[model samples]
Target: MATWHRLGLRDELLARVPFSVTLERHQIAVFLHERRFTAISNICNHKGGPLCEGRVRGEFVMCPWHGWEYSVVTGKGPAGYDEEQVPSFAVEERQDGVYVQTPPVMPRKLVKHKPSHLLETHSKTPGAPPRVLGISTTAMDEANPRFSTSDALLEHAMAMARELQTDTQLIKLRTLKFQHCEGNYSKASHACTWPCAITERDPEDQLSAVYEGLVHWADVVIISTPIRWGNASSLYYKLAERLNCVQNQITIHNNMLIKRKVAGFIITGGQDNIQAVAGGMLTFWSELGFVFPPFPFIAHSRGWDAEDMQNNVRQVKASAALREASRELVERAVDFWKMLDQNRAMMDRPMERAGRKANPLVNPEDAIV
Candidate 1:
């Protein structure tokens, strides 16, 4: 049995909907709805956000940290996710004051998470070759499949990688269903956790495959994206934002999750702006600790006046030189990977950018966001 701790006068709490206070050294949030008072833990179950500081919406409270929801009355999540519940306490009001029963902290359920590829021990065989992965960010709806010139070039690049006897895998972004970045990085730099805070909260997100490939499986990564409005595909940017979680680990934890990884790009668009798109890609990947080869990217663009989309696709499909260039791009990327692999022990750790050492300041999610 637990003892009762007097909170405050009943009238004092009735004025505020969710009156928060410390009782018996435990943070509790008292809520009054339908003329009944209820108490629950003030800490969010997801990331330990201050639940008392969150706003109420109907019967549920939305967490300010990562937007997790829990009912104030039952301490349960929405339908289909009843298992995601918070701790609730028993409360009562006497003639003099309101009080809450402070019980010994109950055992929290341990979440069993799948093993992260970043922590896996890599086992190399006798003279094993480097594995290469090509990711294509060209949007083509499954219902209405269109001939993607960018995807075409990516296929050619990976095909050449296979011919060179390197183990190759191809991933098409259009084929996977993944969520967009929910602006967790804007909350705080440390809030953007590795493996993604979102991915940890919501399982079944397809971005896990990409993470595994980039972190554990591949030595060389070739990314291909089609330009949209003088930029890379929207899917590419969505994946980029999720990948910030990977780099955030480097920024705050100094783990170097992407060590000795080589990256190259293939950009194809009907309109001209390859340099702008490629520049953005290079800067973004470099910040995440990915090294590039000499002439790391290959691009194809007709011109600013190429209004006919059909002719652009037709021309790209028939160009033998473009196909040959894709092969050369893979060969050059592999050459860089081989050179770095020989002296990787000395080259890997030093490649980490200066000032990226482990940060001591703990930046919380609720720090002014």
Candidate 2:
């Protein structure tokens, strides 16, 4: 037998249309369009985003988390995605109140999507030479490039890695066209998925190259960035923000994507604050399960008042000590990676993540150890 439950007074419910009400264990979203009331499941089919909190788009509701759309009335996705539908309920407007029926008239259907290629497991090859990836986060005009202090140091580091008989690759952030992070994790912890929601949706996102290098290809990662106004470059922050998906896997799931990998840094800039920049970078990579080599970073700065950009470039290019330090940084990373490879069995154990986990959202009495 079907049961109808009163939601609220008709006028009140009309004003608060597209709101969610929990009846027993069912969460239903109520919407009012063209003087008619409709009700559907409040949970989004994509990541369980609250549909009631989403905005109405034409005849559909767009999920706030990742923009999955579904019909407000029929609870079906737009056009070709019609197969992906949410359950809809029968709604009635009485003189006294508004009511929604249990046992939805339509049933929810989900489309099975193949897992993203970035989600594939990665393993180090036995007896294979260590691979080093240099990420230059110094932004410049790619069409007509200018000399960057950070890039120069990074290039020297890559050259040293090659000389050390290790495989090497360099990625310049200025060359790649990728979108900034949309903060899906802000909506919900589970919403920030591995492989990144952006990478899954857009095939042209070049951040996949960086992800591929860090997660699958490289045994050692050396990040080079120029300090800007006492901080790391804007490009570095953009890359770091997008990398939240990587660190979040440890927070939500106990999965650590970066394991037995070594990380080092090259910091160069006209402005001061090398220690601050290196500290932040060290903390972030450490949280991602990357072990740092001793003396893991090399940096150079002209100081606060030394804003002669030309001399800054000239100094970085002309400094043999700085160049030698860059080489040494990569050498340290390669040596550390070799040690980790040799002790692969001991290092492969599950990471100890007791104090770093997010607090579970549950009643204290209902919590299980």
Candidate 3:
């Protein structure tokens, strides 16, 4: 038997035609397709894609990753696998808000294993401290023609991150001589093809292993890039391609290398409008499960002219609003890291001893198991 649940208001649906909400024990995704509101589990039965983020077609929710489609009304996959139905809940629209009645069931699996450090009891506990991670891209250094405002924004972001006392990683994409694209659609073949002998000859031009390690170790990352022709510089885009490769590897192993890591964006451009660059980067972050901050600090009127960069730098240094924005971002990064630490702590407990169990498939170690 099913019961009706109050999910949200009708007005809220107007803002997000397709959105998701986590109830007492279920991750429910709501969708508005063909003038009707439908609620289904956020988890995909096949690979656990967030159905809420999927595109709403005429009558189905299309998974963004592999094109898997599910009927909104029935919560069934396109292939008609009778046993593949996702749990559906009864929903109601009242007072311009929507609500859902879910079928009580076991709690959904925790996203990741909590880190052990968070569970330790410390004497003289102080207030929660902020955690920050400064990230720098080396696209501009490579002198790629596509270098744009995003690179400059990333540089400023790194400086701000340093001011916040966060860990920092500077990634120079040109240094990584990695081969193979795996299965990226953008580039059929591997992007880097430099021979090792040549790489050794110009070791300085090689990618930095320390930086890559830091990226894997950091809790939060702030990415900066320059805009070129209303988009990220070519070097940044290439770096994005390599990052996607790493992401794919992590996914295959089921590792949580990127799980719970907060992402912030900094972009700079010649033109005042930065929507195109910011939008593209935001979309990438969202797809990767990154929690993006509310505002993206985009600096405009930046160019190759050292004078222009210096002038913009002066304005940023003088403006109180810029300072406040930096402080806010640092604070948010800290809070996000704390929450992640707590959650990781929960996962560190010995399941049998703590009276809690987890899906072995989703466990960090078991990701490769």
Per-model clash counts, in order, read: 0, 0, 38
lDDT per residue as tens, model 2, 1-369: 689998878778767777888876677888887788899888888767788889897789998778989999999999999999888999988887888998788988888889887877776667878999999999988889889888998999999999999988989988899999999989878778788999999999999999999988999999999899999999999999999998887776667788899999999889899999999999999888799999999999879999798999988889999999999999999998888888989998765556764333322111111
Q: Indicate the TM-score of model 1.
A: 0.76
Model 1: CA > 4 A from native: 1-41, 55-126, 141-144, 187-191, 197-204, 350-369
Rank by TM-score, highest first: 2, 1, 3
123-225, model 1: which lDDT tens digit per residue?
5674688799999998877898999988899889999999999998888887888898988778667657777866776777888888888888888999999
List TM-score per model, in order: 0.76, 0.90, 0.44
* Runs with alpha carbons beyond 4 Å of true place in candidate 3: 1-131, 138-165, 172-205, 208-211, 250-253, 296-320, 345-369
Q: By TM-score, how accurate is candidate 3?
A: 0.44
CA shift at 334, candidate 1, in angstroms?
1.3
Pairs of residues at least 3 apart in sequence or in different chains that clash in candidate 2: none
**Best candidate according to TM-score:** 2
Best of the two (1, 2) by TM-score: 2
Per-model C-alpha lDDT, please? 0.80, 0.87, 0.54
